[model samples]
Target: MSTILVTGGTGTLGVPLVERLRALGHEVRVLSRRSPTHPVDLREGTGLDAAMAGAEVVVHCASAPRGGDDVAAGHLIRAARRSGTVTNVVYVSIVGVDVVPLGYYRTKLAVERLLEGSGLGFTILRTTQFHDLLARVVGAAAKLPVVPLPSGVRVQPIAVEEVADRLAELAVPTPAGRVPDLGGPEVRTLAQWGRVYLAATGGRRRVVPLPLAGKAYAGFRRGGNLAPGRAVGRITFEEFLARRDRTGA
Candidate 1:
């Protein structure tokens, strides 16, 4: 069994990935800022090398959407290089990160480049936005009397468990650089997603289309963040909502 270390092991994606890895008989070491055993902050790099020791694979799932992802990736790369035992670094990236023009997407792309040149075996899996994220966006917008959405933007929301499954399959000793993108079963506009969210949560609000400016919004409008050709995820957004409702989560 390979000794694997997972950054952000307590996160939405990392938790399921770690569970799957442990079920597969891998010795999973969870590295997080608040981890009791491996309290390592990726942004600062403290205790990272110690936590990475003897780890054959490192699944990088930790990310900061507000900023600082590049700094964390740099610290992870340096710590992995110092460990000498870590052979593979599997990264989960967002689809269309190269073309999205969003700050977070740009940071993700930069991290991918850093991994490519880190002189270590690496694999990258780019996936569409998660169902949870889409719900959060719609939920937040629904709070206002008039929910404003981008004029022409569609999203393919995938299940986090399905993504975790794919990541676990890639967290092996061998590295497969830049695998095929994974997308949700359906592609729907933001309006459609918003309607669905309202129906699920019993929310009633007026939804308006707001034409957004800037390259990032333009990229979103152009479907740069979608992978229609690679809609392999099984769970639809409705199904995700139903499950959440059942669990009261």
Candidate 2:
């Protein structure tokens, strides 16, 4: 079994990715600021080398949407190179990071470039937004009597488990750079997703489409974030809602 280190092992995608790796019999180390055993903050690079020591593979799932992702990636790349033991680094990125002008997407794309030039073996997987995030967005809007959603904005929401599965498969000793994009089985607009949310939660709210002006919003409207041709994800938004209802998650 390969000895692997997973960053952001406590976050949304990190939690399941760590579990999946461990279940596969890999020696998995979770590198987190709050981790009891392997404690390290990616932003500060404190204690990172110790946590990364002897780790053959590193799955970088830790990310900050608000900012500082590039800084964290720089630290991770430096530490991985210093370790001299890390053979593969798997990074999870967003689908439209290259085209989208969002600040967060720009940060993600910057990190991708950092990894590309780091001289270490690496793999980058870009996927659509997660189902939970979409649910949260819809839920937050449902609080208002009239829910306002972006006009002409569509999203492909994929299950976190499916993403974790793909990440696990890519966490092998050998690195495969720039794998195929993973997207949801269906591409639906925010209005459609809001309706799905309202129907599933039995909430009564009038959904309104709001046209927003911004380069990022325009990119979204143009479907820059979509991978309709690579809709390999089997789980639909409705199925995700049903599963959440069943598990109360």
Candidate 3:
């Protein structure tokens, strides 16, 4: 078994990734801003060198949800090169990030470019939105009397577990640059997702579809980020909703 370091090893996807890696019998080290075992702040490069020191395969799962994915990726790439110990760098990225106009998606795309140019053995696995994350967004919006959704926006949400499994599979070997995208089994409109969430959580709210303008909305409306042909995830949104209330499946 090799030493695999998982960044953001405590997040929605990270948690499951770590569990899966350990079950596979690899010596797993988790890197996070607050990880007690291997705390590392990719933003500051704090403890990153040590955390990455002996890692054979490093799964890059952490992200600055607010932005700065490029900066974080730069820091990790530099640190990994300096260590000269890491052989493969596997990254978990968002599908459609290259074409999406959102700020976070731009950051993700920037990170992909950075990795592509880094010359390090790396595999960037782009996946669709996680079901849990969508639920959180809908749950937050449910607090309002009217839950507003962008009209005609379709989403293919995959289970975090599935994303984790893919990351583990990619991390175990030498890097294959820009692997195929992963997505949910079914594609549904954003409003459809909201309805599923509202029904699953028993939250009552009026879903208001509003026309959204902007490059981001336009791209989303056009499905610029979707990879229908690469939809490998088996779990449907409905099945995910059935297990949503349960903690950490």
Candidate 4:
């Protein structure tokens, strides 16, 4: 079995991808700042070489939720380049990173550039927002008596588990640049999603649409963030809500 290193193995997408790799009989190394098994800091380049050594594939799923994704990507690139055995560096990125003016998206785009410039075999999988992330957004909005949503914004939210399966497949293959973007089964506006969420969680809130002004809104309005042509995910938003309700998660 090939040795695989999974950075951010404990993250939203990383966790399931790691599990899938392991189940497929690939030896999995999980990079974690806390865990001694593969403790490494990509931001500081600390212990990164040690973590990546002897790993044939590096699935980079780690990110700072709030910010600093670019720095983290840099650390991973440096480490992977140092590991001579590393053949493919797989990065999970957002679909609209290239077009989105948001800081987080910009960092993701930066990482893609880093991987490309390194002259190493790499595969970048750009996916739509995960169901979990969308759910969290709704959960936060549910806290308010009036739920605020962006108007003219629709998202194709995919299941993290499905994304995990795809990542594992990509890791086992030769590197490809920015593979087909992955998206959910359906596209729905933020307002539509909010209503379904409120219904699922037994919450009542007035849904108000905000006609925001900004590049972010403009990009979203134009569907720059979605890859309808690459809609590979099978799980629907309603199914995600049903699962969430069943699990109380």
TM-score for each of the candidates: 0.98, 0.99, 0.94, 0.96
lDDT (C-alpha, whole model) for all candidates: 0.93, 0.94, 0.85, 0.87
Top candidate when judged by lDDT against the true structure: 2
- Estimate candidate 4's RMSD in Å: 1.2
lDDT score of residue 191 within candidate 3: 87
In angstroms, the error of model 3 at 218 is 0.5
How many clashes (backbone N, Cα, C below 3 Å) per candidate? 0, 0, 1, 0
How do the candidates rank by TM-score, highest first? 2, 1, 4, 3
Q: Is candidate 1 or candidate 4 better by TM-score?
A: 1
After superposition, candidate 4 runs with Cα above 4 Å error? none
lDDT of 2: 0.94
Candidate with the larger lDDT of 2 and 3: 2
Return the number of clashes found in candidate 3. 1
Which model is ahead, 1 or 3, in terms of TM-score? 1
Per residue, candidate 4 scores C-alpha lDDT tens digits across 45-86 of 788888887888998898886888888888788777888888
For each of the candidates, the C-alpha root-mean-square deviation to the true structure, in angstroms, is 0.8, 0.7, 1.6, 1.2
